[model samples]
Target: MTTELLTPAEMADLVGVSVDTLRYYERERLISGVGRADNGHRRYDADDVAWIRVLRCLRDTGMTIDQLRHYCDLGEQGVTTKPERLAMLRDHRAKVEARRAEIDRALELIDHKIDIYLNEAAGDAP
Candidate 1:
């Protein structure tokens, strides 16, 4: 079956981002394969949506625009750049993991405070 091409609004809704953000991604070259309708409206195919999802993941994981641009450039370079792409992703993963650990520690502290509050409210605290 052929995938349905989506309009800009539909794509933005599906991707849980604004149309302006989608345009920004296109302008930044973070996503590719976006088509245009005869009326000059932007159309997105499944492949474009998939690439946008990857861009969202990288952006949400704290990758800078320049870093993402470099990654996109590497991707466009074909199979020969696989090693470099892998290295970049690996490094990014490590950074994400480190941030996760920091968030976990902060959550533990917040939980401890909540427990203390609960104990005080329940008259079980010293």
Candidate 2:
């Protein structure tokens, strides 16, 4: 039983990131334990894909690089650090929620402005 490994190009395409980004993450210590092929090229397995997806999600949600480094450090320490990771994730989620609320307010303001402009355009302004 074996899983086919992905080339850097393939991994980048599958993970929706550039090959440079994959290299950057590897260099940044955010991605570790990457397997190497006989030609010494990086080969990504299913586990690598799953972990990179997690990294992408955290980054998309605005987790800072420093925060990600710490997260990855804990992850490297294995399951014994789950509690700390949970705490950090909880904190990050709170910040994301707060930012979401702020964006919601900004969106409401934008919608209001759009409605006003639309009304004015239709000669329906008060």
Candidate 3:
């Protein structure tokens, strides 16, 4: 099987990020191994796309650039760094869980207020 390659625009579309964001990730070294075409345009292969997806997940989950860079660095070190990577992910997961709990609490409060209004509309008392 052959590996598929994508142009910068195609990559951005496929990854649901702007071309500028792709370029920014490249500049920040959050993702790497983008090839240059004969005309000096950037080309991304399947692996690059996979890495970009990982970067997207990390960014979406509020991972800082430095933390992402560290994670990527550990990933580049091969399976020997699995423990370190797992530790980092565990730490990040805790943060995400905490944030999720806080959002859940706020959502519960909103639902309670909505319930009050709904009950009042139904001619119910406090």
State which candidate has the highest TM-score.
2
Off by over 4 Å in 3: 77-80, 124-126
Candidate 1 residue pairs in clash (backbone atoms < 3 Å): none
lDDT for model 3, please: 0.89
lDDT of 3 by residue, 45-89 (tens): 888988899889878989999999888888888999999999999
TM-score of 3: 0.85
Candidate that beats the other on TM-score, 2 or 3, i.e. the better one: 2
**Candidate numbers, best lDDT first, in rank order:** 2, 1, 3
lDDT score, candidate 2, position 76? 85
lDDT of 2 by residue, 1-126 (tens): 559899999999998999999999989999999999888999999999999999999999999889999999998899999999999999999998999999999999999999989889999655
User: Which stretches of candidate 2 lie above 4 Å from their native place?
Assistant: 124-126
User: Each model's RMSD to truth, in Å?
Assistant: 2.1, 1.8, 2.3
When sorted by TM-score, best at the front, the candidate numbers are 2, 1, 3
